[model samples]
Target: MALRLDRRRLVMGGGLGLAALALPGGAALAKTLLSASGFTHGVASGEPGPDSLLLWSRYVPAGEADETRLDAEIALDPDFRQVAARGVVRTGAYRDWTVKITLDGLEPGQTYWYRFIGPDGSRSQTGRARTLPVGRAERFRIGLFSCSNLPMGWFNAYAHAAARDDVDLWLHVGDYVYEYGIGSYAADDRIAERVVLPAHDHEMVALADYRLRFACYRADPDLQALHAAAPMVCVWDDHESTNDSWEGGAQNHQPATEGDWSTRRAAAVQAYLEWMPISEEPWKSYPIGDLATLYRTESRLIGRTRQADIGAAYREGTEAALTAFRDGVWQDASATMLGSTQEAWLARELRANARTTAWQVVGMGTIMGRTVMPGDALDLLRPDLSEGAVRSFANAARAGRIGLPMWMDRWDGYPAARSRFLKAAQAADADLVMLSGDSHNAWAFSLSEDGRPAGVEFAGQAVTSNGMEKQLGVAPSVAARSFVAANPEMAWAQPSGRGYMMIDITPERVGGEWIFMETVKARTSAVAGAHRMTVEKGRRRFTA
Candidate 1:
């Protein structure tokens, strides 16, 4: 009998379906009896190309000791009546029981349903995937997301986007999973029903810990639905490994206790690559027909220099100290975000894509626009803040008064590098649209280089992590207005929200609509509000 499953049914049914087989005594025996030996997590697809796509699924066998062989099938129809491509792949404990296979020889711009079949007739949940277009294309929509801290709330943003048919792709810039352990970073604030996995109750340090963390995140029904709905292009931010990670070390990673940074970083990367539906390459580009070239770059682990310590500057407690820190440390001409090799590759790709496509979209972690905290906004800080927190905010505001941006972990910290990137875009005469995350708030920026308009950036709000409203005493509206007034490049700001962005790309324009959720505390996808901003074809700036 053929098992036909729809999206809703697959979503409601948490696990994969296993067909019943007749026993020797003529009784029907279901494979579900072996609860530990089936598709553990749902299926996912990513790394889409004109004729290829990468498919992923995790399968646990009853034996658990040996490798498990599985069959992968892709079809234009959900029922698999018209099978397009089929393959066999193996997964074992080595890769955390996760299997990823790249299926080629498919038509471009075609939607296909895929699933994995086990030896015992168990079938994974059906997932839909689409290939990138080859020639001229009219429009493309991407659901942008980041910073999904599970303990904070539900993934209503993912659910909202997954339920919609408009989004063709999912672009998660970074922080897909937070690395914090139980009782730290919003633990007390966690939703009542959401509990941390027993094995992942501590900060992730080893490969096994990272693997369990990903499994916990992937187990979310909403996240699985999002993955099943469309292919995702994802990258890891600092949280995937540790907070504020750079090339050599991280702000949160203490080598003395955490062992070698390199060892820990390797484990994190290995687990991420094995668990996520992405290719082995850390940075790559996806060409969306002749419409746009979506470039995903690595900004955190590869070439990023250590972030400047504004806390140290604040401790000095002097304008001269802040100025010295800004000029000497923050503005280091040689500091880089994407590093030298990736930067050069991106510059070359930007120029090349500009010649071929109408729009050049760069997807990377962290906000690229300049955001300086308004001095008056500091007074709006919540009265509950500790003395040290208050002092830090005060120092940040003072530094902002001296023309320094608030976040040293973002593009603002690497001014010279940002200038170089903008200059590259300017030289190519490209219609650039930069999509970013990691700030946890929404922002629109009109980028410029040497007083010339370079491009526009749409920084998406976090999926669930709290924003400025949680810390500021003032309302979100007041904070947003103050931020816009303080930063000239910032054309718009949403100081508080938990949601994602729907970015539409067309030949004439590219627009991003920030869709805010009603409440992440509940398991609902109700819409609270939305804000839209668009940049015309050649203007390289947001419209009035």
Candidate 2:
């Protein structure tokens, strides 16, 4: 089914509402009009405030061009009838032909359109931007997305969300771009059209390589549309640098082949800052009027301890040995997703905003809810499976029987850290609503401590990455039922889906819907299904 978008119909209810209509054009349509040869990458705005936001664009000067100075315009109308703000900025080859301008003197909670002018008097494509609400707002909508792998499939989810007008702001939790080399993250026989940039076919390790990678991804029309449609808040996950990244190292990084971790990490960070329309702060929180407090946290690379190797724990041989390893070292308190410093900051933020904001939403990278392996996980396997698959399924089941977390990459591996964060939220008496994306699966969790409700989590599926069905070789419905059956805290789940989420917040409640697209293999706005969950104000729990 085609996406049902209402750009002009405003959502009015409780404390929040949906504003209809979004700027049109899917990826294919967008590509036909925008190019990378000149003002190739479309314009974007982000790091929004009540009165200001950053506008960005890339310009390639004409032959033997000496000057890099260009003019930017912000207007009330698409045709620039009402030029609200205008400024000139310079972009040299040093910064890869990209320029950013911070425009001020604008009203809060209002929509504006902007564009850039080249030295040759040519104009960039128009873009839309919105400022954060200052005081009381009727409602706010935030689009959540993650794990957009170009080689996996088309970015249909990004296209679908870009076509919706209800979304006031777009927040990409992480994995904005993959770091895998060619024929790495994707299937060996990947689709020809889905192949990634050949400029740096190998994994991104240096600053120039990372810059090229971002340039390649930014060239995408759907991604460009998402950025052009509204202001965005973003954070990078491990894949942005390398897989399972932490404070010290990463799973995908090999010092011998990749060089120093610190050097590579620095390159990734620099490239991200130069390309994205964001501020320099490692992490920050945003106030959406009195409705919600959105905390965008840096979950990977900053403070996280290295993720646990659950597979190693399972390889301990004897049943008793496996049981011992699973309980003892697996539950280490030192293992953290958020280091002590950030953890304290988060705790204080939760307490400080509890009294004012109706909802405390933490936009993070990984799944915070507990997701264990199914006890009968092996039963779903086919008889012709390889030995390695059987062994993995057996270990998964064994780990579940012993109450060990199946995936160390998520918060489940660091239960103590999660517990501390949840307890801190509970202590603050906060109405917590967690927004997470990384698992590539949709999940609704009712978080609790000591059998008492603590909060709720809305985990969005990947933009195109394969999910549980592909990972575990199970049917979508079967995976959903099994996940719910295995985890009491999980209210619902769709373990095999590729899409994003729409989170609507009001003073009275928080509403969310996981919008599943028909396919990412083909460029289409058709939707296959949607699952919705709601949490009443002050309840700290979602409706079943």
Candidate 3:
């Protein structure tokens, strides 16, 4: 049976009683009890295909601890008067009361409203989902987002995007939910209003911890609204598990204190799958009709090796040591960003997509373009910066003096892997468009391999994390100009901003507009500013 009221009206009318849980402060207590019963964390949809998509929701009976069943339905309208599909799904504590149902046999290029119904007739907030077009897609816009640390501030970027009707899908490259505890990585001034749940005030390391963290993030109204607005394609970066995570361990994880790395990694992955509206596949591709082929690649846990220690090289205080590290460790041909198997699959996919599509877009976790900090840029560092941040900059500056890129965690550190990927694109003669997030700053890079233009990259800024402006003493404009001047491949840079990227794909070109929020410190979606850049088809670079 359909709920008589509209979904938006239901939420605005406080039918679900989540307004207090969505706010800050005392809401933390409500969040903690949310999982005990009822439909918690609004509905979401993802893993969209031409004829199918995955629906997700979390529900628990008030007095039941065992598995419970819920009825799922889809319709052409919010009122469900035109009911199109229906199914039943089971959820229990084993899966954290989260339910995911993959509904197939649906029409292509259509929008559907979906909701879950409890046994007692309670309904989940309606969620909107879309299926990929089968052919001749004139245009598709993806709202690109990442690095959303809740305690940092309001999710203004998400709120802004949720208010838009143009975005066809949401692509969160990584760091959807940070693993940090309260105050560990949040803005000091915003802690009172953006507090992490006290029960989860330590870095997440266990299954329960990760589940609680996801619950906390999902309780936010802005995030839930975004999920409800459209289907999302998401992947996890390091922070979803821990900071700077790789195949074996993470920079922030201490085996001595955090238990086994594999155990923690397993818990993180399990919680992610249960909470997110994604498939079990580590990587996958989406075909947007004949206009574009979007490949979501995995770059973390599956096959990434440990990041090279650039700081250690710099600490050696000798050009010889730095050169040795750069030549031997940093450029190790066998070290991979994406494991060998995924690399081969990506290459094959790129070639196949190029044969039929106008664009081959790769969405990954980190920036792919080379970003060597100019030695002179160090002069802009803020004196009040933490010692660790200063040291990191110093090392990067030292490497820059020798023409080495900083941030070994990025593609720059795995030079051979990057070269191989670029060569694959060049060999396929593909019109490549790379989308990335991880760095808190906005960037546009003209990618090249051996002086031959290979692709163009539009890396989005963080939704709320502090960017270079927080660490640098100079103004944002000066820092951006300095960065652009320092890196040849860099076409543009926004050193300071809290925003998301809007990527518009057409047969002729792909355009990206970075939309910055006026303030994350406040709960507002007023636009601060925006910058647009585009690459023409077959250009292999951003248009000048």
Q: Distance (Å) between predicted and true CA of 44, model 3?
A: 0.6
Q: Counting only residues 3 or more apart in sequence or on different chains, how many pairs clash (N, Cα, C under 3 Å) in candidate 3? A: 0
User: What tens digits encode model 1's per-residue C-alpha lDDT throughout 1-544?
Assistant: 2211223432212333211111232122122322345787788999999998999998887764678799999999999999999999998888888899999999999999999999898899999999999899999999999999977888889888999987779999999998887557554567644443322236889997788667667867888899999999997899999999999999889888889999999999999999999998979999999999999889999899888777777877899998898879887889999999998999999989899999999998998998898978667789887787677677778989999998899999899999999999999989999999999999999998899899999999999988878788888888888888889899999888799999999999999999999988887889999999999999999995
**By lDDT: ranked, best first:** 3, 1, 2
Give the RMSD in angstroms, all C-alphas superposed, for model 1.
Answer: 5.9
Instruction: Give the per-residue lDDT of model 2 (tens digit) for 58-162.
Output: 887756664488899998889999988999999876777778899999888889999998878888989999888977887999999999987777788989999
Candidate 3 ranges beyond 4 A from true positions: 1-35, 186-189, 198-201, 386-388
Q: After superposition, how far is residue 108 of candidate 2 from its true place, in Å?
A: 0.9
Worst 10 residues of 2 by lDDT: 13-22
Residue runs of model 1 more than 4 Å from their true location after superposition: 1-35, 186-188, 198-201
List, residue by residue over 412-493, the lDDT tens digit for candidate 3.
Answer: 8899999999999999999999999999889999999999999999999999887778787888888888788889899999
**Backbone clash count for every predicted candidate, in the order shown:** 0, 10, 0
| TM-score top scorer | 3
